[model samples]
Target: MSIVTGSLFALALAASPATPAPPKPATTTLAPGVTLLRGEFVPGRQPDGNTIVVDAPQGLIVFDTGRHAEHAQAVLDLAKARGKPIAAIVNSHWHLDHVGGNVKLRAAFPEAKVYATGAIDAALGGFLASYRRQLAQAIDMAASDPKKQDGYRAELALIDAGERLQPTERIAASGPRDIAGRRVELQVVAPAVTGGDLTLFDTVTRTLFAGDLVTLPAPLFDTACPARWSAALAALDASDFKRLVPGHGAPMPHEQLSQYRRAFDGLLACAASKRAAAECTAGWIADAGALIPDAEQAFARTLVDYYVGNVLRGDASRLEANCAAPNDLH
Candidate 1:
C-alpha cells in the first residue's frame, strides 16, 4: 500500500475502486531456475517494480518484491509452488513499490536475509519521512470517508513500519558474489535510482537485473539523478548481458537494452535543451518507439513530461538534492 504515496493516493483514490482487483501480474520463467513476477503499472495508479525469483542452490532468492498485497502474494505463491523456502532477498532499490513487501516476505520467511544497498537507512529519515507526513494529512482528510481512509491508512502503515524496510544485509560493492551457493554478479549504482540501486547479473543465465536504470512507460524520475542515470545506462550498455531484466515491464534482449539507452540519452539531452517540455515528451515517446506499447504511450508521455518539468528542468535544487552521496557500495 505504500505506493508513491503523496498526491498519488489522493489522485488514485478519486477514481480507483474501494478495493480494486488488478489482474494477476504476468509470471514468466526466464531461464532454468529464474522466475519473473512482472510489475504492474495501471494507467491511473502507482506501479509495482518487477520481482525476480532465482532458484538458488541454497534456496529461493527473491529479487525486488512488489508493492501491493496481491503482487507480494504472487511472489509468495511462486515460492510455495516451488516447495522451497525463501533463503534471501535482493532489492533493486528503496522505492516502496520495489521494497514495500519486505515486511510481508520477511514475516513469511523469518530466516531470509535481504541483500540490498544501505540507502534505505537515510530514506527512512528523508524522502520517505516527508512522504509519511503527506500520507498522514491525506488520511486525516479522508477520515470522513471509510473507503478513502482505508486506502490512505494502508499506505501509512507501510511507511510507519520503519526498521522492517531496511536491508538486513547491505551490498556495499559491485562484483561477483556467491549468495546461498549461487554465483551471481552484483551491480551497485547510486544517485541514479534512489540513493543506491542493487542490480544482479547471473552469468549462468546471462541475465542482468537493471533495476530502475531501465523502465517502461518511460524512465521514472522519482528519485533519479539524470546525469548519473545516464552513466548507469552506459555501464549496462558496456556489459554483454544477453537478457536484461528491468525493474518494470518485460524482460528484454541486449539489442533492446541498447535501444533503451539511446532513448534515455536522447530524453536527457532533450530535457537539458531549450526545447519546450512538450517537445521533450514527444521526443521520448518517439525515441522509445517499440519499447513502449501503443496502450502505454500516453502514460509514457505523461511520465516523461513529469520528469522533465519537475526533475530535469524545474529547479537546480531537485538535481542537487537527488544527487545524494552514493552509498559505500563500491
Candidate 2:
C-alpha cells in the first residue's frame, strides 16, 4: 500500500488510464454540520478518501482531502459555497490519496494549519521515494502508452508538490485537541495501517472518523500489520462513538462497524489457518456480506483473493515492513 499500485483499489484506478472519465466527487451531508465529499473510485482514475468538512465556530475544519485536483476543488467548492474560511486540515494518514490536496487547500487558505502524524517524514524518504523511482521506470517503459504516461506524471507531480503537504501540527498521542475552535479526539495508531494513522472523534456528533482502519468492501492490508491492525480496530470498537466514518464507503452505525470487525478478524484467522486461500477469500466475501453491496461484491471478491494470496499469508516480514520491529507485531 506504500506504492501507488499497492491494492486492488489502487490498481482499479492505476492499471489503465484509457477508461471513461470519473465523475466529480459527490458531496453528502453525513449529519447536521458534518459534510462529506466522497472521493471518486472511478475505473480509470486514482481514488481519494472521503473528505469531511465540519462547521467550526471559527471556520471549516477539513479532514482528509482527496488525491485528485477536482476532488480537492470539491472541498474548496464546499467551503466557498458556505462562505467560510478553512481553518484547519486534518490528514488521516500519509497516503497520497488522502493528503494530495493539502497544497491545493493551503494555497487558498494560507492561514489554515495542517495536522497529522510525523510518519510521512520517514515515508517520504523510504516508501514514497521507492514509489517515485518505480513510476519513473514504468513511465520510461511505457513509451507507447501516452495516456498511461499522463497518469503517471499526474501522480508524480503530487510527489514533488509544495511543502504545504507536510503537517504543521503533529498528533503525537491520542487525546482531545482543540482544532479550529472545536475539540476532537485524535488517536495515533501507528504500525496498524501505516507508520502513522489518525482516527478523529467529533465529540459533538459522537462520531469517530476511523480513517482506513475500517474501509468497506475489504480492508486494505498493503501497508498494514495484521496483528497490529486488529488491535487498532479493537481500539476503535472500544471508543464511545455512535456512528463511524470509514476512509472509503458510507458512514455506518456501530453495529455495521462490528460486522466489519468480524469480517476482518475472520479474514486474519482464515489466513493463519492451513485452509486454502480460496477458503480465506470466500470467508472474507461472506463475512463482509452486507457491507459489500451486490454492485461491489465482484470487486470485493477480487480484492480478498489478492489479500489472501499476496498479503495476509504472503511473506513473514511484509506485514511488519512499516513497523519498527517484528518482535512486537501485536
Best by TM-score: 1
- Tens-place lDDT per residue, model 1, 1-330, is 122423334336555546565567898999999988888886656678899999998899898887787788888888999999999988899888888888899999989988999988877877788787887886787677777667667667888878887788888888999887899998888878677888899889999988889989688776678889899998889988889999888899998889999999998888888999998889888887899989888878766777787667766766677785765652
Q: In candidate 1, which residue ranges exceed 4 Å CA deviation?
A: 1-19, 327-330
As a whole number from 0 to 100, the lDDT of residue 59 in candidate 2 is 98
Off by over 4 Å in 2: 1-5, 8-14, 42-44, 325-330
lDDT of 2 by residue, 1-330 (tens): 344336643464456556544567878788888998887653345678888999998899999998888888888988999999999999998888899999899999999989988878867776677777877887897788887777777777888883667899877777999999998988888778888888999999998998899886778777777788899988787778889989988889998888889889999999999999988888887887888778877767777787787777776665657555422111
Tell me which residue pairs clash in candidate 2.
Answer: none
- CA shift of 287, model 1, Å: 0.6
> What's the CA error at residue 231 for candidate 2, in Å?
0.7
C-alpha lDDT values of all predictions: 0.82, 0.81
Please give the range of 10 consecutive residues that has the lowest summed lDDT in model 1: 1-10
lDDT of 2: 0.81
In TM-score terms, candidate 1 sits at 0.94
